[model samples]
Target chain A: MSNISLSAIFAETAEPCLATPEMNRATIFFLIVTVVGLSCGVLAFIFGHHTIYNNTREMPWGMLISTYAFWAITSTGLCMYAAMSHVFGGTRMGMISNRMVWMSIICIMGAFATIGVEIASPHRMLLYNIISPNPLSNIWWMGTLYGLAVGCMIIEFAGIVTGLGKLALVMGVFGALAEVLANSCLGGVFATLPARPYWYGAQLPIYFLTSAFLSGAAAAVLFNYLAYRIRNEKMSTTVHLAVKSAGKAMTLVLILYSVATFWRLVSFYVGGPELGRTAADALITGPLALNFWVLEVGIGLIIPIVLIILSRLENMSMLAFAGFLILVGQFVARYDLVVAGQNVPQNLGWDNLPTHFSYVPSFFEFGVIAGSIGVVAFGFLMGERVFGKTFTQKEHH
Target chain B: MNIEDLEKEKNEGIGSLPLQERREFLKMGLALTGVFLGGSILSMTSISHASNQKNADMDIPSEGQYPYPKHYGMIMRQNRCVGCELCVEACKQSNHVPNDHGAWRTAIQEKITRENSTEKREFRPVLCNQCNRPPCVRVCPTKATYKDPETGIVVMDYKKCIGCKTCMAACPYNARYFNEEKYAIDKCNFCIDTRLAEGKKETACAAACPARVRIFGDLKDKSTEIYRLLHTPDSKIWVLRPDTGALPNVFYMNA
Candidate 1:
């Protein structure tokens, strides 16, 4: 067959295509939302500085830190899943991998944006870190590696869209490796802190990687579903297969993650401090109990798992709802990890310290977090609108 | 040849030596010049001393009282503390810290509820413990946080801080705080610049406490009060989170 005929045959087997008008509308809408969201985030930082919730000396890191970790971990998960799909030549995910790659890149950018506002002096941090260069510090590694990973992934995504598939594959592998190391280092930062017994453990890095896979799969399925809805098209067979495969991956990782999270808490109760135990108790029976049990475990894990199973992992709407639940649960999980880790007092036997240190994220912190989500959503939509054709095999006109 | 010509030829031969030998000869010449300079310096010193003999009449301390003992570490006794806010006040004053919403040092009042329905409340002044192997010092990417070799106090140079709060995470003691307005991390420095360096006897908190629950002295010196307390019966010395291996210097007397 001639090259043109072969190309035509390839195009015939591809999925739904977007019209120019639909693409333009989606791009414009996403751009506007992103601008508004980012503006709100910036305003929150400015105005929230004057608020009472700027994290006092008693509680140095509050909501902002947790939110930053959540976005970063989720981004790692997305990138890893995308890279894994490509590496294994998974035919099911081939249609959505391009879009997933874009999502991963945008999510990481969102993570950076949230962290930039969360930090007191980002410019000074960047400058000093580069000039001094401490290889021993986990924060140094996390920041440097993530920056490289994000750069590589963006380049990889660009290459994929521009038909440089070979270059894209190489960049994708590099990006994925960088993210894995960076995410593990992030866990290492917490694990190495012997002071916070709740966080000090060897399992954190592995647990983080597992959750990343879970969340990444959920995010991919949700984004793909959203793209179909926006384009006013039915879910294609290839898309269905992709969602089903991701659903299976999510279920497996979620179970593994749940086990790790359970034992992590149990270990704290068994050998950790009464103060640390009390902090853990807070998760099971204290103020955070509802968030932990109801949102994270119930809605986030159990319900999603059951729904995915009942649907035979084929129902698009059911799976999307599961994805939403998982994302919410993941957010709570991040919050619980950060807040619980610090709630325990250092002076365990002392009678003079406060009963419980209180922390509630200021409005500005929330705004910044919301704005980061907006940035990710905006990026995803814009990428789809511009390169939607590349994300999937082209369908006949 | 005449004697002058012979001397000149000998000097030329010396100059014609290999480079290493010439360098050795140059070094010897420099050494001789240095000796001559030293001799001249000694002579000039004696001459100047003779000319300024009247200034030598200034009082000089006896040999036994000449050099003072060096101060190394500080200690705070729990029993002697009266919960006076003097240390907190003095810290703010000494550091020129802003008065709005941050504190370099704070006093926490913990109310204990006993199992037998008894209630007891105690006030504990809290600041950076100045750990020997400080986690904050280790975690700072910019090395903005450091431990003083002479005083053994962990000090933060605010100008160098980027306010990442990694130090905050690393500190098991929850001692470090970020100054929101200035966007710099702040913690207790044990008043190194004001009290310790000025040859003062004690920290502001120890000196100002009317009940005398605080003691400030060198832990290393055998004669110092801290060493005696550390060795005394029922001393019950404890450093926060010994498991952390920070080797904190801020030893507490009672739980």
Candidate 2:
């Protein structure tokens, strides 16, 4: 690979599709939203989380935590897919693997930004997480692994951009491994909490990994569709085949995830702790019933699988639309899983407390969630503009 | 009264208890009942008077086998707590906990149940258990909350805390809260820096309590009231949520 200057990379806008004024306007719009959303996050720092957030002593984690998890899981899924496609070169999915790598990086940054604000002392986290490390902590491992994955992915992306194919593949392998381990650690954070019966046990780590693949596959189809649509260009035969392959992966994972989800809920009712049953009931029959039944179950799982079957993986628009709905469902699924686990009080019968605690995310919390979406949106547009050629062309080592 | 007549009578809840009558009950100082009210209520009521109970010894370690040089603990005579909240007030003052935000280092839990047209009320005080294996310490990403090697007391290093609230979720007792002023999670530190560092023997809440319900001492020391109270023959000694396997130092009894 030759030495490529930053100026040369910026000036070399070889792709005609991304040079349009319309694409520029869309990018600017997302940029403005990103600024507004991030400013809302900054407001929490100034006002203090206690005043700005609706999170109570009972429900300490709100919607932001779920959003962070959703984005992180998606990123992990994307990273793994990209690495697999690269390793198994000449597969239909390999055609769009480079684009997947780019989107994965963007999604992880979005995750970081959301969590950076959700936590009160991000600076302390950086400092003490290094100096006062706790090897036993699942959260500690998650943070460290994600950090390593990001570093590897960024270097890998650089290698891809600079035409260092061998370096890219090596770093991609490490990035994928880090991401997979990080994803499991994320699940461990919830699964190992014996205090929270709803989240306890060994099922959650595998459950989260399954979810990562689901979200990853959905994001692949959606982003690929958007890439073509944004450019007002027709999809190449290779790109079409790659998206179709992603659709097939999405359908398969959807079925597996549905089974996993069913058993997860069933296990709670069959001889589990009463507290755990009540927690599951929070989604099955209580306050979160609407979110669970409609968004998580009907929209996120069943409908998407049916749509894919109807389309027979041939209709591009149908596949993309189904992918969009799947993403929405997955988002709501994360929220339901987080909220339901904490709904039942720890000391339920002791205090004169309600059977289930109520938590409503504040306006600022929504703003931060929107801001994370904006980050991904803006990054997608910029990536298309800058790395348009790299994404569209087939790579060779 | 016959069972039919008792069932037919109107059940008066704690809401109907007169102020004078409540005061009289407090003066009487009834010992907490050790009756096990079924398996459903085991999480709320830990003490069991049953002599044949095999699980009673599981809540605590065997006698004279402590993990720390000074295994500090507290025993709450749950029945003596009348919900006066003097201890809560004292905790707030000592710990600098803000009242407006519902930030509490310790609090009272009032349980009212009706059985056969009779209303029964019980007040239970809760604080950080200072578990031998604290979940908060286990989940804290930065070792912000750690068990003091010397005292086995779970303490916080606020400067290292990231305020992730993972520790809060991991705590089985719901004993933690985010301290906005400190920009970190805070909980009952057993007044380590407040009174104990000042050459005092007891915590602020224990000292403020009028009913002598809060007993604070080193459980490793056989002479201390905490150790004696927990070891008394046939005493109904228990700790909350022993199934969590936290091996909490805090004891609840009717000593």
| Model 1 lDDT per residue over B63-151, tens place | 24212244344455665555667767766776556666555664544445566787555666666777767788877878788877666
lDDT of 2 by residue, A138-216 (tens): 9999999999999999999988888889989999999999999999999999999888888999999999999999999
Q: Which residue pairs in candidate 2 collide?
A: none
Q: What is the TM-score of chain A in candidate 2?
A: 0.98
lDDT (10s digit) by residue, model 2, range B96-132: 9976556898999988999999999999899999998
Candidate 1 scores a chain A TM-score of 0.89
TM-score of each: 0.81, 0.91
Error of 1 at B205 (Å): 2.8
Across A307-361, the per-residue lDDT of candidate 1 in tens digits comes to 8887778788898889889998998898888888777666765655555666778
Worst 10 residues of 1 chain A by lDDT: A1-10
How well does candidate 2 match the true structure in TM-score terms?
0.91
**Candidate 2 ranges with C-alpha deviation above 4 Å:** A11-14, B1-52
